[model samples]
Target: MMLSGLDHLLAAGLVVAVPLCGSWSQRVLERATAEGRPDARMRDYHLTMLTLWSLAGLTLLLWGSAGRPGSLLGLMFSDGMRVLIGAGATVLALLVLVSQWHGISRLDDAGREQLAAQVGSVLQLLPQTSREYRTFQALAVTAGICEEVLYRGFLLWYAAVFFGVWPAVILTALVFGVAHLYQGVAGVVKSAVVGLLFGALYAATDSLLWPILIHTAVDLQAGAIGWALRGARRGAV
Candidate 1:
């Protein structure tokens, strides 16, 4: 389906808006944490994302209706086999990553320190308390849903309207990586790689569900680990 000029304009607006919003959100998080209000910051961050993605989803639905009714749902749930395969692959990947955490002690001192530093960098964003951890889990789920909807479902579809599918996928993945600039270079690279995988899953299944499940699982595990580390550090102090 070709996008009208108006649709293109709207798509361009979203492409610009999303990254800017991400940068703004990072700043908000930093400011809130500096003020000793991480929980409040997280709540605000989740609320903002929920609202932003909800509007993006609605806009995409309305735009997509010009092509076919229920096409949006079809796009998000096309192939069960593909979804299953994607889910299985993601689970295996998660298991490997988690297992590595347990084997950190087997690494040399330099490797262990490097791994710890990487994990510590990520844990900075994790909630430090049980109450906050529950909220963090919800945030992870929300991120999985909303981010896939915006980046994969909405942005990819819009990009495909202009560029071809492969071009759109690469462009969308690059943007996804850039959105993680706050996470540093390694984070950006990791995010882009994961984004590429998620894009492949979406392309394979023609469905958002598979990517959403994978993204949520990965985020949940990271959050859990970060929370545990934070608690341990506090106990030691």
Candidate 2:
């Protein structure tokens, strides 16, 4: 699809805007922390959900206004073989998530400490209470749907206007990674790798459904693991 000048402008705005928002949020978080505000992270969660959903809604609007079919965003169902492939990939991902959860649950104190150190950069945003965990769950679901739409669907299409499909996939994946810069270098690397996986999945399946499911599963699993580890550390203390 040949995107118009307006479309390019919108895409550029989004590419610049998301990371800037993230950086701004990080500053807000730091300031809140310095001020000893207890509700800072919760507020951050709410704002993040709002931003992601808004961006996703705008993307849909832009696509519709451009007379683009939903299929172009990988919203339509594929053939039987594609469905089977998506299903198989989803099941495999679920199995892997389950295994990872099991391994995390069995972490010794030392192991937990090591893991904690690795994730310390983003610990401020992680859930500590049941209510926060529930909120995080909602965030996970929102991110899974909205992010796939904005990044995998919209950004991929936009980038493909300049780059070919495969290069667009890679470029979008890198941009997705940059979107999580607040998580630190390790987080950026890890998120980028996951983005590549999701981008590849969307490319291969020609449907966004599988990537959305897997992305949600991954986020949910991460939240559960973080919550469990935090609880374990508290009990240990």
Candidate 3:
């Protein structure tokens, strides 16, 4: 195969580490919430951001060491179609932002609590304060960049060496979903489906630009939804 032994080892390690870290972080957040720790969510956000960035750095280092073209990692828009798709994705993201802001701006007290209760399983991980929400926004952006790079770009490329392109796409998507193991079974399923969509997007467009934009927008929308719901819950107390 084209992959070195070192590459295999690193890939295996990451597959284990990502889900383990996610599950552990969720547990920590739950415990902190139970204990009434004010900074629990913010701390979790910070740690997660650091972890994602670090992993992304490792992927970049490996790419460079292999003397691979950066373009291989979906770093550039090399065609008019890619550029058009990127522009369309950007516009879609802007629309999503506007929609989320509008929805949050219109939530009444009951509506907020009702909406917040919908995400009850992981509510504790959501931001309850303005500062936490701000930090979460940053975390969301970081995740969009790092996750797309690591999963769709690097992991897909690496997996394709053994599995071929289409199989690699599916495998990377499953891995991406599993990495959200902290979300539990249903969450894992949902995330996996989303991951599949992202993988397909990458495969179709042959670039990460639009996928990154769409991913960031999805996270930003989720954060806004959580903040709206949490704000209501906090007020109710």
Best by TM-score: 2
* lDDT tens digits by residue: candidate 1, 138-232: 87887888778777877787787788778888888887888777777778788888888888777767778878877988888776766656644
Pairs clashing in candidate 1? none
Descending-TM-score candidate ranking: 2, 3, 1
**Considering TM-score, which of the candidate structures 1 and 2 is the better prediction for this target?**
2
Displacement of the residue 212 alpha carbon in candidate 1, Å: 0.9
Report the Cα RMSD per candidate.
Answer: 3.7, 1.9, 2.1
Mind giving the per-residue lDDT tens digits that candidate 3 earns over 1-237?
A: 366666776688668888998998899998998898888898999999998998889888888888888889999875878677667766876786788779777878877778766666766677778999999999989989999999999889899888788898899889988998898887788888978878877887789877888888888777877776776667655
lDDT of 2: 0.85
Model 3, position 133: C-alpha lDDT score: 90
Top candidate (lDDT): 2
lDDT-superior candidate, 1 or 2:
2
lDDT of 2 by residue, 186-231 (tens): 7878888988988988888899989999999998887887787785
TM-scores for every candidate against the unseen true structure: 0.79, 0.93, 0.90
Q: Identify the superior model by TM-score, candidate 2 or candidate 3.
A: 2
Q: Model 1 scores what on Cα lDDT?
A: 0.70
**lDDT score of residue 125 within candidate 1:** 72
Candidate 2 is scored at a TM of: 0.93
